[model samples]
Each structure stands twice: as C-alpha cells, then as structure tokens.
Target: MFHHILVPTDGSPLSGMAIEKSVALAKSLGARITFLTAVEPFHIWTDNANQLAYTREEYERISKESAGGYLDSAVAAAEAAGVAVGRVQVETDEPYRAIIDAAVERGCDLVAMASHGRRGVAALVIGSETQKVLTHSAIPVLVYR
Candidate 1:
C-alpha cells in the first residue's frame, strides 16, 4: 500500500490524464499525493518558442507561473478526490532527475506518471523523461498511458 505518491506533470493532455488517474489511485489507497512539475531553465540557443521569445529573467518567471498552474490543477484534482496533496516545482535542465530527486526528498513511495509512448528514432532523438525516470529511479513507478 502506498502511503505517499508522487505525480509528475508537464501540463500536457497526456500528463493531465496521469494526474486524474493518480488522484483516483491515491484516493483508493488512502494515500497522500505530491504533484511535481520540473521547469527547464532558459537557454541562450533553443528551438522552444517560449525560450526564444524572452530574456532569461522573463523566461524563468513565465516558466514558474506555468509550472504553478499545472501543479495547481493537479492539487485541485486530488483535493476533489479527497486525497491529501502537496506540490513541488523545480528548475532543472534534466527533468527526469528533478522528478526522481523530488520523490526521494519528499519521501514518496510511488511515482506515477504519463508516457508519450514514443518509439525508435522519435524517442531516441527527443528523449523521454518518463523513460529516464523508469530507468534511474529506485522507487516504484506506475505509468498511465
């Protein structure tokens, strides 16, 4: 039985589904949840429109706001489900490491997340934080497709 679960989201529809499912699972298990969103720091050269549009300070500010919105949504879901919840937002280039570190620091027993289900070249090129978490984490992971 999981006493505490960590749910990671990136504000995508896929992650939203994972948040809903994780809240339901936490409710069923009488467990508390920690919602986490890892925000990547702004880089000088990048393809991301948001990063390209703003200065470092502006990008950081915008990223934090976005992450807060995502975490708030998850918290609301868990609250509605009667599942106790907390949230964490971290700034990191490596979101997978941030997710794992947050789970361990927060004492979460399970890490529940969504998978984009990429394969072959797409996965290899874009890389998968979910895949990295699955590979690196010592704790249990429950993936929602």
Candidate 2:
C-alpha cells in the first residue's frame, strides 16, 4: 500500500532495472514516483593547494548537471509507463545520506533501489550504500538486485 515511491538511480544497469521495477510497482499500486540522483562533490586536496582554489559554485553547478542527466532518464521511463513522477537532483558526497534525505523530504512511503551486490572483501572495502540506507533510513526499503 505505497502512496509514494522513491527510486534512486546512478545511470548504472542495475539502477536502470531498479527504476523499471519501481515504475511497475507504482503503476500496479496507483502510486506516484520520485526519481533521485546524487552527484558527488568535488574533492579538495590540501596537499595540492592550487587545486583548493576551485570555486565551490563551479563544483555545485557540475554536480547538479551530472545528477540531472541521470534523473532525466528515470523520469522518461516513468513517463513512458504513464506513471506520475517527480525528479530530485542532490549534490552530496554521501549518496546514501542524500537518498534517505530526499525520501524523507519528499514524504515517500517506500524506497526502491538496486543493490550493487558486493560480497565479502569487496563489500568491506567499499561499503554498500544500499546497506547503509537500509540500516539508517526510517522509511521502508525494497532492494532490487
């Protein structure tokens, strides 16, 4: 019984599949969808002081563009399925945090995302964002692999 569904996409094949799944689920339940993409902020290296001179405004602009492109695809898919949808592009270094924040801000009833499905050493080395969201989010999460 989901009224609003939040789907995060990173332009990956897995994320594409997740978007499709989310759209289908929303259509079946007569729910609206929110497609979100988080762009990573530019990293500043103190060792290379010259690089630190980069403007934060420039970084924010680039991040917004990047996230917008990814979210556009998800929006297109939802539109094709005749599902009502909204898009959100957030600039954040922490993708999981951004995703959860968007969901809460949008008042989404559920979050449907794709898992990278990392395992063992890889999982430990590059912690799963999906896992982190599952652990920390107050809203319900449905992961698609």
Candidate 3:
C-alpha cells in the first residue's frame, strides 16, 4: 500500500522495463509516482579521456540534456499509463545516494528500480548502483531485473 512510489531510471532497456512495471503497479495501487534521474557532475580529473573532451560548462549542459531525455521518457510512460507522476533531476555522481535522498524528500514509500543482476567480479568491477541503493535505503525496494 504505497501512497507514493519513487522510480529511478537511467534510460537503459532494463530501466525502461522497471518504469513500465512501476507504472502498472502505481496505477493498480492508486499510488503517485515520482521519476528520479541523477546526472553526474563534470569532473576535471578523471581517468576517462572522453570526459576531458568537453569543458566543464559543455559537459554539464550535455549531461543535463541527456538526463532530461531519460526523465522525459519515464514521464511519458507514466502519463500514457494514466498514472499520476512527478519528476526530479539531480547533478551528482552518486546516483544511489540521490535516489535514496529523493525518495525521502519526496515522501515516497517505496523505490522501484532496475537491476542488471551482475554478480561476482563483474559486479564488483562495475559497482552496481542498485546494489548500493538496496544496501543504503531504509524504504522498501522493488527491484526489476
């Protein structure tokens, strides 16, 4: 019986699945949904050479546009499903933290998100944000793989 559901997405195929699932769940439960997207801030010192390709201003602009696109798709899905929806965007490298914080700030009772289900060395190397959110969040988490 979640009154408010927080749906965090990255615009990936798996995240799209979670968005669809959460929209259906929200519609059934009569819960309002809040879609959250976290955009990484521009970092001057990064190992990735691609990051250095853009200036700080340019990188921030590009990141915001990309994040906005992701949030827009999620919003469109919820709207199409006739579900009440809101959206939040934060500039932070720690997406997991942003997800948890947004849920609390927005008074969301549950977090519905996607997981790649990576395990072993791959998971450790990639460092799953879903795993981090699961570990850190106090609210209920519905993970869609």
Per-candidate RMSD, Å: 4.3, 5.6, 4.4
Better of 2 and 3 by lDDT: 3
Error of 1 at 32 (Å): 0.4
Model 2 C-alpha lDDT per residue in residues 53-112, reported as the tens digit of each score: 446576556546655777888899899999999998766657789888989998999999
Provide backbone clash counts, one per model: 0, 0, 0
Candidate 3 residue lDDT tens string, 1-145: 8999998877677778889999999999999999987776666897544457777787677767776888899999999989999999887767788889999999999999988522211111013888898999999999987
Greater lDDT among 1 and 2 belongs to 1
Better of 2 and 3 by TM-score: 3
Q: Each prediction's Cα lDDT score? A: 0.80, 0.75, 0.79
- What is the RMSD, in Å, between candidate 1 and the native fold over all Cα? 4.3
For model 2, the superposed segments whose C-alpha errors exceed 4 Å read 46-63, 117-127
lDDT at position 25, candidate 3 = 98
| Model 1 ranges off by over 4 Å | 117-127
lDDT of 1 by residue, 1-145 (tens): 8999998887777788889999989999999999987777777887777777788888788778877888889999999989999998877777789889989999999999888532211111013888899999999999887
State which candidate has the highest lDDT: 1
